[model samples]
Target: MTDKYSAGVLLFRRGDGGVEVLVGHMGGPYFARKDNGAWSIPKGEYEPELEDARAAASREFHEELGLFVPAGDWIPLGDVRYSSGKGKKNLIVWAVEGDLNPADVVPGTFEMEWPPRSGRMANFPEIDRADWFDLATAHDKLSTGQRPYLDRLNDYLTQTGE
Candidate 1:
């Protein structure tokens, strides 16, 4: 069977504290109040027929973060496949060096039936908050499946001597 796929951009920057990457706290009831494993890179699913992974990554970044990713050389981290409720999902990510104050992120919204059986729906930001975390801290905060992107970014940085 054909599995689903997703794409995302891992935006990082060097700061006095250390190398930091932006991660988002998922919204909606499911993730509310959760911390560890609750954060993820701004990303979303896209079909291969719709757009190439890179293009889909850029589009998903804009859609989830509510801002276009700043132009930069995107360092590919390749794909990682993980299981989801529906099936397996292949997440394609690229690391890009840039600066953005996560406090400034205006995440897009999604509507869902908040009370489970409630007959009403409510709108919630896709990401309730975004923050820049040092690599070590980010590792602890990121969802398990996406953690590899951090390792890939670090290895690339070391190789490039950045």
Candidate 2:
């Protein structure tokens, strides 16, 4: 089977406290009770054959967070591959420097069968909430598979002296 691919934007900003990243808490019941390791970069899966990765990233960023992505130079943070259940998947991410109030977020929604096997369908926000966390806090908040993007962003900033 072909591996699945996803693309996303890692929105960050530099402040007096240093760098901070905006991430979302994954919605739905499975992640409802979790905190640590439950947050993820705002993203969504896309079929590579049907869409360009960068465009897809922008689309997903809007869909997931209900916010217009800030205009800036998107610094490529590259991609990482990880196993998901029985299949492998790749995530491509780019870092863009910008700031926005988390409270302004109006997250989009997704429909899924709640309680796993019930016949009823429920709509849940793609992300229950969004917040800005300092680099260290962000490191702990992001899911393991997506954590490498942070390091990549740091390297890019360091190399450019940003």
Which one is best on TM-score? 2
- Provide the TM-score for each candidate, comma-separated: 0.95, 0.96
| Cα lDDT of model 1 by residue, 1-162, tens digit | 679999999999997887999999999889998999999998999998878999999998998898889889999999999876688889999998898878778999999997998889999999999999999999999988999999999999999899
Each prediction's Cα lDDT score? Answer: 0.91, 0.91
Residue 23 in model 2: shift from native, Å? 0.4
lDDT by residue for model 2 (1-162), tens? 779999999999998988899999999888899998899998889999899999999999999988978999999999899876558889999898999889999999999998788988999988999999987888898888988989888888899999
Cα RMSD to the true fold for all candidates: 1.2, 1.1
Model 1 scores worst on lDDT over the 10 consecutive residues at 80-89
